[model samples]
Target chain A: MGQDGSVPAYENASKESPQPRPRLRRSVEDGWIAGVCAGLAHHLGFDVRVVRATFVLGTILLNGLGLLAYLVIWALTPQALDGEHADAPRPAPTSLPRLDRAIRALRTSGRDEAFGNVLGGLALVVLGAALLLERHGVNLRLGLVLPLGVIVVGAVIGWSQLDRAERSSWLNESSFSGRRGVLRVGVGLVLTIIGVLLLATQERGWAGMGDAALSALAVLTGAVVILTPWGLRLWEKVKREQAQAIRATERADIAAHLHDSVLQTLALIQRKADDPAQVQRLARAQERELRAWLYGGGQSAETTLAAAAKAAADDLEDRYGVPVEVVVTGDHPLDPDTQALVRALTEAMSNAVRHARPPVSAYVECGASGIEAFVRDHGDGFDLDAVPADRLGVRGSIVERIERHGGTARIRRLSDGTEVALTLPVHRPVNQSLNQPVNQQTLPLKEAHDA
Target chain B: MPEPRATTHGPIRLVLVDDHRMFRAGVRTELDDSLPVVGEAGDVDTAVEVIRRERPDVVLLDVHLPGGNGRGGTDVILGCAGTTTESGAPVRFLALSVSDAAEDVISVIRAGARGYVTKTIVGEDLVTAIHRVADGDAVFSPRLAGFVLDAFGAAAGEIAEVDSELDRLSAREREVMRLIARGYQYKEVAKELFISVKTVETHVSSVLRKLQLSSRHELTAWAMNRHLL
Candidate 1:
């Protein structure tokens, strides 16, 4: 044994333990038909030739009783799994490797109680009898016996596949089993066809054989039609259960999101219920986030009076937790003059929303003549005459800014609401298209706010 | 502010139509006591029935309702098109909605509603709008003005150049709409544009007629549909 570190951990584990048990499975590598005789000889320390000869004789003397027993054993036994020896690399005896293999198989078999010992002994007897008959001069009909043997071998190959346990094991495990099953079944079918051809060509007609094959196919199709619905219902049930599991996982994800955001915000709002402003702020923030998440596709990127007003409105709403509705009729591209107007409008809107009852409304219209914006609130109107002109509340924020662009701002007190109207005339020279880019250097300082 | 309890004729009879029970209750409480609510309905069929039975001066129609063969407020407006008050004046519809969608606003307007106002409007402004609608005058909220300007301004641009006199906004009409969009009252818009208040109302009424009755503006309708869809 190399006993190197590269050896698999299982080999070391097997050596350290008392012994590694072997399972009662047919030998795939050594089998002539289904590997039953080879696996039996290996397990019982008998020669494989001895096992084979006994079965052949038993088939002749027992009137096919031995064949029936072999078929039953083949159906019950699992074929040796590929890589069984790979689990532990056993050292082979130098002179007699076959004997050593038998001994090793025997040793592994000893790890667990030997299964079907009586059946194994019976196999030895059959092989012994066949070996004796071969030694003697036994005259048999070669034509009849050869065809029957070939047919029986094909039948045995197909019968071995009836091991439902092994078939289903790899059927659930991987596609490799399906491929292997297809290949073996193909070989069995070819063998059976060759045997049938031989029997038909031997002083017989093909019509009878054709009739038999047609009848068998008809019976199989009838059986299939009668049995298909049971399998279909099983498949549908599996599919439905899979879909249900996926929906459950999605529900869990949504629940987690609600708990992390909505529930936490609700708890915070409850704690700050005494402060109406704080509660409103929290609730509004949560609602906006949830709506954006649900509807997807957040605000679009645009540089227009409407977009700027929306951004300003969103900012004020976030800060104060009050609703600001900004409605713009005609959109105009941002310019130096328009930028000044938007700044004044933002200031006016902030003052109205902050000091007055909401939801505040801002309306901006861009016509061929000019662009106008109004911020209105339905609170107690403020007396413009009472406010000092030196303060930055209205004069500095709204009136003076619009005056720079040769526009006007008016704070009118309506009977039901207070309105601040700001208008900026279209200043682009008649020659220039409104779509063309203008000189950016005229006002670079305030350009960042547009973004 | 003093509530206008009754006009020279009488307090304007009103019919309330909205799907949400809570919202209808809130509006009733917030409304001026002078505008006597004659009837109420929750869907289009009930609204048409109530309007025909009560002959209210103004019907506050919700844009999105649960019923009416899926057309909502538009169906109600069309269904009650022939209904009139006992005094022989036609019943008017004023749309109220929380939707800012241009399709919802334009559809109801096209279906013969006199005005459109968002639910966020102040109680006093809503009362004033209702009064104006009952008085056979068109009422345009700032948002509705914006939508109108957007729809008519860009749409039919090609057609407007070919025939500027028809299916297009005149300079005066554009100025009136812009002023209205700036939250200017009719009196204020007249003052700002140096026109009489009666002339301002005429401009607004003409705009409304062009918006609703113009069959030559197929391009406008197509553009609005494409923009909405």
Candidate 2:
């Protein structure tokens, strides 16, 4: 993480900063029952083979529980995740603003979400209506309404929950089979009850012959209607290509470290602390641990610096009661302590808040090495000589701060009010040394796919 | 280097808070006779609980602590950052830290400290700083003073002239000039100034011209250089 955590490492260390995070969507060509696995693998930067292998291993280990789970994913997952649709490549790293504009420009993405929610609401309504009709002695199987109603409800909620899983990255996990089972049983039982009600209506209304034809038509139409949105996904295609490219650029040693160690240790650390000191110690530990992990005996590419700027923001909020707004724009480790510097920044903020007779705007910037905090009160300025040597509101707080850190802090009267600034040394991270480009030992992604 | 003694401003009931037991003991030893000890705490959590109970007028704080003891747990600095006196009551903070880390100094102060004096402060200075902070006057050690001056200089451009101005005037000259600047004429300046007109004139002439100005208007302008007007 960046030395203090005020900065996001991904924006600094990664060669691919300009790229925004991927959205989950359908993929067309690599359709393993509508590309749910591919889309998930692509979104989270995992190998589809590994994801597929994980599912395979689990199926074997669990006596084919995994395969049964896969079939359910095939049934319940919204078909739009298939990659055959969207034609976009992974946009270049520098194209972020344009990408956001592109996303905003695309009316279809919002339209799709709106369509899903509307369908979900409609599905519930129709299912309720058909059951009511069935109770009223109207035949829907020989009739057209009841069975069609069940499919409609199933499609709507099914798409909705699938979207949730997409947003959460659940499908990328090796335990997805287990997770999908939970997803299905909960949703499946409800949908199954609706199915039985629809069937009950069938027995009361139409003959078996007409009911049979209508059921086939309903299934066909249901599949077609669900699959139509498959034409609009953007995340799927871009994710697949970039993922293919990353796998091609992958160093085996780096991949192994990421898979076998880092995440597990971080999960342990996240669980261990609740207070600032614990978090600070853990953050420092993360820095050292991540460094050791990076240079460990294995050959490595640049360490992944996906560490967030907001984690630092959260830490600052927790300890200092200071609100920090972070705008991440580079690649490097953004650790937890960097955010806490806002407390230092609020030296300006607090002076303005507590003592400014006529309140003025104060602006502050915090970074790894030091902080610059300044406040201007709109009220008035005073004589330095007449003013007592023991200026408490400021010198007690603002100026002494720099000395405490072996840095610098000061306050001065402008034409209007006082301004203060402080700078402190930050622990420099090894990731900074990686600013020099090194050749990535390319991965076998395209080779694996082409083969 | 002078030994500390109890002052006439009543007991500045102080709490010694730091994770380092020896350092806390040393401060307690140094200030025990000069300032009454309400309690002692060594971690953020316990320090917090102690300060809440004792309500000491002054908290002597250290920046770093062990056992998750630093920052907010029982630390008075962290606890007091958001706290203020209820209408009228006195609770102040004097930070005692070895760290000259700028960020830490700034943080403790922002976290509600009233003064910052280093651990290296002599027995007398530390006691004096504690009393001053308790009495609602903030204090900083000389080293921190320089840093603050540097920060101020950097922040609002420069104030070498103020120090230069002080250097240019003698003590008596400053006194005479103060009266003149307060609107006293040569005779009135001489009366309040406790000097003869020739002396006031000499002081005023030196104050005006040496401050590099030609007239009383320019003298006032030079005196008011920072725009306090």
Find the candidate with the highest lDDT and give its number. Answer: 1
Cα lDDT tens digits for candidate 2, B24-92: 777777875658888888777777777777777778877776544445322456555444333245566
lDDT of 2 by residue, A1-451 (tens): 0122212222242233233434444342453444545555554567666767876885787555455444334333444433433543432233234543343345335434434433433444454445544544754333344334344434543454434233223223323534663554345444444444444555543455455345444443444344333322223434445666777677675677665556665676688656655654555445434544543333232231212223333343445433332221112332322322333445545554344443333333333344443344434655544544434434444444334444555555544455444454456442333222222232111100000
Candidate 1 chain A lDDT trough over 10 residues, lowest sum: A442-451
lDDT of 1 by residue, B69-111 (tens): 7879999999998898777778889999866556677789889
Interface DockQ per candidate: 0.17, 0.02
Place model 1 in a CAPRI quality band. incorrect
Each candidate's TM vs. the true structure?
0.55, 0.29
Tell how far residue A251 is off in model 1, in angstroms.
6.3
Model 2 TM-score on a 0 to 1 scale: 0.29
Give the number of the best model, judged by TM-score: 1
